[model samples]
Target: MTRSDDESRRVYATQGLIDLLLERAAAADPARENVVLDATPAGEFDADLGVDPATPVLTHFYLPAGRAVSDVFGVDLGTPAGRGRARFLTHPQGPAELTRRDDLAGVVLLAVPPWGTETLTAFDRQGRRLPLTVLDAEPPVESLPE
Candidate 1:
């Protein structure tokens, strides 16, 4: 197969695995149901990119309840509840800034650490804490040189 075709297969497999894991985790905790799962520090990267690694840009995927947040809001991306809370500013441009994919099954929120610091906590609409099974933020080991 061509390299592109092989890569496509790998991507699909990886997504399948992520979906399966999320399903199981959500099943165990009703609070986690239909919520975004945040992976921050575990997802930090070098500052070589345009963004500051210390002010990590964390993202989570969730099905939108009624479009976007009305205004800037604070949220916990960490587990055990209150340990992590950060404020997020809604982009004036809206979701289109993130993805042009009309076929997307859910919305993706891009959140940056507060004051160049990291925190982890997640909450449902009712402001109740939700459990999260964070995935590694780094690239796959296979992508690295031996």
Candidate 2:
């Protein structure tokens, strides 16, 4: 598929993921807090991430990482979708980026705590989990691709 086609798919997947998690949160406990991650430009990710900027990156990583990350909202409910909806747009399993990149300690994404502790647990393809910081919204960036 073309780059634009791929981007469109990723955007859909990211939005769908947010909607699903929020919906689930409203169901399990409407009063409960939920997280909404912001999918920003690839260039913005370069600054926040410790990984080598040379590695080709996508606008969204966590979502396309795999189903394992899809269910990040499952943290409180104890149920992960096991496959991220964006999995089709990117990698088959594990993180969208290389599992072990010298510049990266792990994947990085903008955390959005629409309501929550501002912290969430996400797992990689190997089932290895890590605590990712969830922000109130995505950080500002200078250049964004159209």
lDDT of each: 0.30, 0.32
- What local lDDT score does residue 71 receive in model 2, on the 0 to 100 scale? 72
For model 1, what is the C-alpha lDDT against the true structure? Answer: 0.30
Tell me the RMSD of model 1 versus the true structure.
Answer: 16.2
| Number of clashing pairs per prediction, in order | 7, 8
| C-alpha lDDT (0 to 100) for residue 138 of candidate 2 | 36
Candidate 2 per-residue lDDT, tens place, 100-119, comes to: 42122223222223422232
TM-score of 2: 0.26
Top-TM-score structure, candidate number: 2
Runs in model 1 with CA error above 4 Å? 1-33, 39-43, 59-78, 83-146
lDDT of 1 by residue, 49-140 (tens): 33224422233333333323423334322233432232222222233122332121122222222211122233333333333333334322
- Show where candidate 2 strays beyond 4 Å: 1-23, 28-38, 42-119, 138-146
